[model samples]
Target: MIDVVAAILKQGDKILIARRKEGKSLGGYWEFPGGKIEEGESPEKSLIRELKEEMMIDIKVTEPFGENIHDYGDKKIRLIAFWGEIDSGEIVLKDHDCIEWVFPKDLHQYNFSPADVSFVEQLMK
Candidate 1:
């Protein structure tokens, strides 16, 4: 199973989301910034590494907001989500095509991965 971490970053009433690049799994879908956990790394460390690689920013990952598990065809993932705050640097899209700040209630407007949809639902509750 893939151990993944997602950052649920908020600025007041809005949260940051990113659109996956074309040709990637769940392409065109929007998701919170995160990636798979590397071997021997803690979830928080993995989140920090992913944010730096994908968003070019330093983030302070907080305690997990929640966790979700889902299967996508050939693979299953265990998602560990955290509420984070930006520490430095602007959000420069490096891996994703684009990024947006969205309200929690308005998250359903865009398409999300099956697993991510559940994560968002948990956030809304």
Candidate 2:
């Protein structure tokens, strides 16, 4: 399975979510901002690297939310979500189409990746 890490970054009552760019896998779907866990890197360490590379922001992981595994026919991944806060840097979108900071209660408004559905449900509970 493809191993990935996602960040559950919160600012006030809203959390950060990013949209996948067109032409990419799961393109046009929303997901927590993060990327794959590289070799020799822990999940949290991978998250810190991904957030910076993708969003140009620094984060300190506060807690691990949980994990989910899902398959989209051609591709499958195990995503680990974590709770974190911005440590530094400006918000820049190096990847993804755009971003939204939304209250979790309203997460239904956007189309999220299938792998993230469980994480969203757990957040609601």
Return the TM-score for each candidate structure: 0.95, 0.95
26-104 per-residue lDDT for model 2 (tens digits) = 8999999899999999999999999999988999999999999898888889999999999999898867989998999
**Root-mean-square deviation of candidate 2:** 1.0
Which ranges of candidate 2 are over 4 A from the true structure? none
- Give the residue spans of candidate 1 off by over 4 A: none
* Candidate that scores best on lDDT: 2
Q: What is the lDDT of residue 51 in candidate 2?
A: 94
Which pairs of residues collide in model 1? none
Worst 10 residues of 2 by lDDT: 116-125
lDDT of 1: 0.89
lDDT tens digits, residues 60-123, model 1? 9867888998988699999999999899999888778988888888888889877889878877
> What are the candidates' C-alpha RMSDs?
0.9, 1.0
Backbone Cα, N, C clashes tallied per candidate: 0, 0
